[model samples]
Target: MRTTIGYTAESIGYVVGAQGLVSFASQTFFGTEWGWLHNVVDLPSTAYLGIVAVGLALIVGGVKMRKTPQPQKAA
Candidate 1:
């Protein structure tokens, strides 16, 4: 469960980061002619902080998954 949640968080982080990049590219490179994604997928100051928090949680979850032992299967 923990590992699954960690992976999920990582996926979300990638999506968020990608959205930010797309927004930047659309507004800066593409002359603000972006798609709906930029409108819905945005990371402002506080949201960026949330992104950082998600990253930290991912790292912590990875470490915990590595340090913790796995359960054995029954015969």
Candidate 2:
């Protein structure tokens, strides 16, 4: 159950991280010309941090999963 939760969290993080990069690109290149797109400039940094955070989350989740014991079948 814990492992499943971790995996879900990691997946969410990955998605957020990828979006951050895209947002950054749009903001950096388009700026105000893109209207609200200018807000995306901070995306690069946001994405970078998100990636790092997600990476750590994955590592921790993986370790937890490995440590978790599997259920045994009845004899």
Candidate 3:
């Protein structure tokens, strides 16, 4: 269960990070033209980088959780 949750978090993090990057790029380079995803859910300009940061944190945490050893069960 722990590993499963960790894997799920990692997957979600990748998606969030990718979305943030695209959104940030669009807004930064295209002069207020945000990514298509922004149309679905708009956020403040500051939140774009914040999203990327959160996504990276989640990825790191998930990787740590997935790598941790589980306790051995008694036979």
Compare the candidates by TM-score and give the number of the best one. 3
Most accurate candidate by lDDT: 3
Worst 10 residues of 3 by lDDT: 28-37
What lDDT would candidate 3 get against the real structure? 0.83
**lDDT of predicted model 1:** 0.57
lDDT of each: 0.57, 0.55, 0.83
| Candidates by lDDT, descending order | 3, 1, 2
Please write out the lDDT profile of model 3 over residues 27-47, one tens digit for every residue. Answer: 777756555669877876667
Instruction: Output the lDDT of residue 30, model 2.
Output: 60
Q: Which residue pairs clash within candidate 1?
A: none
CA shift at 26, candidate 3, in angstroms? 0.4
Off by over 4 Å in 2: 32-75
Which of 1 and 3 is the better model by TM-score? 3
Q: Give the TM-score of candidate 1.
A: 0.51
lDDT of 1 by residue, 20-66 (tens): 55555666565663444545655443454454455566656666665
Clashes of 3: 0
Q: Which residue runs does candidate 1 get wrong by more than 4 Å?
A: 41-75
User: Which digits, one per residue and each the tens of the lDDT, describe model 2 over residues 5-71?
Assistant: 7677667655655555445555556652222323444344345456446656665665677567878
